[model samples]
Target: MEQPPVTPRSALHTRPKSQGCFLVGKSLKPVVAPIYKKNGIFYAEIFLNWSHIVGERYSRLCRPVRITGDKPNATLYVGASRAVAAEMFYSVPTLLERIHHYFGFQILESMRFVNDFSSPHMASTFSPKKEEAAPQNSEEADASWKGDDITYPPLREALMRFQSYMRKIK
Candidate 1:
């Protein structure tokens, strides 16, 4: 009788354990990518990963409070003090770009900063040694246009910071 011919194993067969091939993070990328972000773990709040997006240095001063708008044209709202907001002024462009890259799509259109120094945490992690005098010029704000009126105090402060940011950018 003629010897039977043997066929090679097909892809449908299980891979051998000795092949040095096993499930790795890359293999599960599609399954795990949605959980991990550039700055931190992904929770329900996408902005919670702000620290990862901006960088350690910038994140220490401020944090992303929330994001608003439609899918592709969203805006990020950041919370920080006037000084920190001004410091992060020039970084907006690069930070925005980084944010866009973080989501892996063009979701955020811009950033709206909120100058919130009411809590000591906004300035830094530790409390101040003594009472610090607030700036006198904090009350000054530019004349509002027809649609630019701000009735809220915090909003006014944020607007002033935004103006200062623009000035520094220029």
Candidate 2:
């Protein structure tokens, strides 16, 4: 009986690991592939359904700015207000654990929460609501105006003064 020739593995051309699916263009791969291949996450959905990742409480105070690198310990940049940034500091471990569990891998070893008070959304999240009891008098208003919660010193002060003036007028 004649023996069939065995194919040698060395002769077979191996595709480069970086080479993305043939169906997707090279240009689109960088934009679309990393989320899935690197983090085992849905790319567009990360931004589209961001609240699902960080939860409703943090979603308003913070937002995922970007994911850097393709390593297992990739850094996830989260934009947050200075006020809420402190809260996130203590919750980093819990958040990372939740994110890892959500992605089914430790795709992010750490999160970098940048205190970006300049973000319009950040101010809205941390700012005191206008519904708070209007000051009984200008004296009380001026005394109550503290700089502690101010995201933008000038802007917040101006707005507070304006609100106080409006209350006086009414």
Q: How many clashing pairs does model 1 include? A: 1
Looking at model 1, residue 162 earns an lDDT score of: 80
Candidate 2 wrongly placed segments (more than 4 Å): 1-44, 118-170
lDDT of 2 by residue, 1-170 (tens): 99989878866777656754566466777886755675555434556777787687767777877878765767878887776788778988977787767767666667898877655465655676668788998779778866568798898889878877777886
Error of 1 at 143 (Å): 51
Supply the global lDDT for candidate 1: 0.67
Give the 10-residue window scoring lowest on summed lDDT in candidate 1: 138-147
Which candidate number maximizes lDDT?
A: 2
Give Cα distance to truth, residue 141, candidate 2, Å: 19
Q: Candidate 1, which segments miss by more than 4 Å at Cα?
A: 1-45, 118-170
For all predictions, the C-alpha RMSD in Å is 21.5, 16.9
Candidate 1: the clashing residue pairs are 39-52
TM-score of 1: 0.45
Error of 1 at 138 (Å): 36
Every candidate's lDDT: 0.67, 0.73
